[model samples]
Target: MINLTGKVAVVTGASRGIGKTIAKKLHQAGADVVLVARNRELLEKNAADLGAAMVVSMDVSSADEVQAGFKEIIREKGNIDILVNNAGITRDNLLLRLKEEDIQQVLDVNLKSMFFTSKSVLKPMMKQRHGRIINITSVIGLMGNSGQSNYAASKAGIIGFTKSLAREIGSRNITVNAIAPGFIETEMTAELPETVQKEMAESIALGRFGSTEDVANAVLFLASDLAGYITGEVMNVTGGMYM
Candidate 1:
């Protein structure tokens, strides 16, 4: 079993879906978790349910909010051993019909948030000389979809960002990696048309859409000491969809 006892972890988008599961799994592995999301009520409820060490309600896409939120977390916890960049959104539209605002919103929330959150945690992580930064990207980023150009671009950006940051901080013993999940069943995926959902499932070699636990488990491994030597890598939790 992977042990993260005494480690402090911060999981953005922790109120629901894969992020929520990741937070719970890290907590189960003995890390003190801090839940970060824009929903205060949901975050508080999850924190109480999971016995999380802290809860920070903020818009992660906003650099000011991310910086301030991390500052507060460090002030109270003294350090952050793990950072999960899981806050993202998809504004799906065909290139011809995609709105300027939709593209910008997707980029800001999906890609820029990672930049902000990763920057906020670097100081504390570097000071400790050890850290794990796991970014939740998507297989869509690797193999683009027809109507998800904006989302694909953002996720692809995450892969580049992860590798670049990993190279920059590997000397500090800070491992940065990205988790690319494909067709994971979550609130977001549930909204897809039945035909689309079935088509997605058929594409996966595993013969089914993945579960939130699948992605969460991958996040757990990347966050643990087991992945200490692994950096500048993308771990696919996609059931062989892209490979």
Candidate 2:
């Protein structure tokens, strides 16, 4: 089994959904986990449930907030070994009907947040010459979707950022990669109408929506030493939905 004992890993947007499961899986693998999100109460609850995890409350979309939050993390955890940039949001609207603020919000939270969080950990990772950066993108990013232009743009940007940053830091022994999940079961998806869900599932070769565990397992693999040689690639967990 893949083991991450002694590794200090941080997962953003970990209060719920895919991010929460990712954090849980990493913690189960023996890594020291840090749960980050804007919801301090929820984060604290999750941290407590983990029995041993640090919680950092901050707006990852802001450069200043990310800098300060990372400083706190470094102070408490000493050094980071894994960074999962899983924080994101969606503002769905047709391009013509999309508000400027919605576009900006999606870009800031879904795309720019990775820039801030990834940059915050570079110094430490580069200094040690070892680290793993895993970004959670989406199938929508790979294949454009109507009414989700902002989300698609943000996710697509993550792919570009992952590739560029991997090349820039490869010599330093840091591997950066992205995971693009297709239709997955989550709180948001649970709220969708049955007809909508069925329609979405029919498109996937798997004939069903994926579980959060499916994505978490992928994240764990990328974070483990088993994938040490892999970098700058996008792992699709779409169950043949976008192939």
Candidate 3:
């Protein structure tokens, strides 16, 4: 078992689904978990249930709110040992029909939030000579999807961001990585049409949609002591969809 005692983690989008599970698992592994999301009620519910390390209500896309959120955490905990950039949304539209706002919103939440939150925690992380920054990317970013140009671009941008930041922080003993999860069974995946779901399943070498636990386990591994030497890598949790 990888030890995580005394570590502090900040998980964005922790109100539900994969992000929630990741937070729960990290807490189970002995890390103090800080939950971040815009849903105050749901965030508080999960935090209370897990006895969360901290809870902050803020939209990841807003720089001011993100900065203040981190300030609050810093005041209490003084450091963030792990950062999970998981808050994302899908505004699906083909380029021909996609509105400019749809593109911008998706980019801001999925890609720009990574920049906002990662930078917010960098100083604390660097001062300690340690950190784990994990970006939740997608297989669509690896293999483009129809009617999801905006989503694809955002996730791809995260891959680029992860690599560049890994290079910048590896010297500080910090590792930056990405986890690209394919076709996970969540409310989000349930929204896909039946035909599309069948097509997605058939395309995966594992012949199944993933569970929240599947992705959460990967995040735990990356955050644990076992992943200390792994950096600048995209850990595809996609069940061989892109490979």
List RMSD in Å for every model shown: 0.7, 0.9, 0.8
- lDDT by residue for model 1 (112-206), tens: 99989999899999999999999999999999999999999999999999999999999999999999999999999998889999898888899
Which 10-residue window of candidate 3 scores lowest in summed lDDT? 47-56
TM-score of model number 2: 0.98
Q: Using lDDT as the measure, which candidate wins?
A: 2
**Full candidate order by lDDT, most accurate first:** 2, 1, 3
Per-prediction TM-score? 0.99, 0.98, 0.98
- Distance from true position, residue 68, model 2, in Å? 0.5
Candidate 2 deviant stretches above 4 angstroms: none
lDDT for each residue of candidate 3 in 113-224, tens digit (9 for 90 to 100):
9999999999999999999999999999998899999999999999999999999989999999999999999888888899999988999998888999999999999998
Tell me which residue pairs clash in candidate 2: none
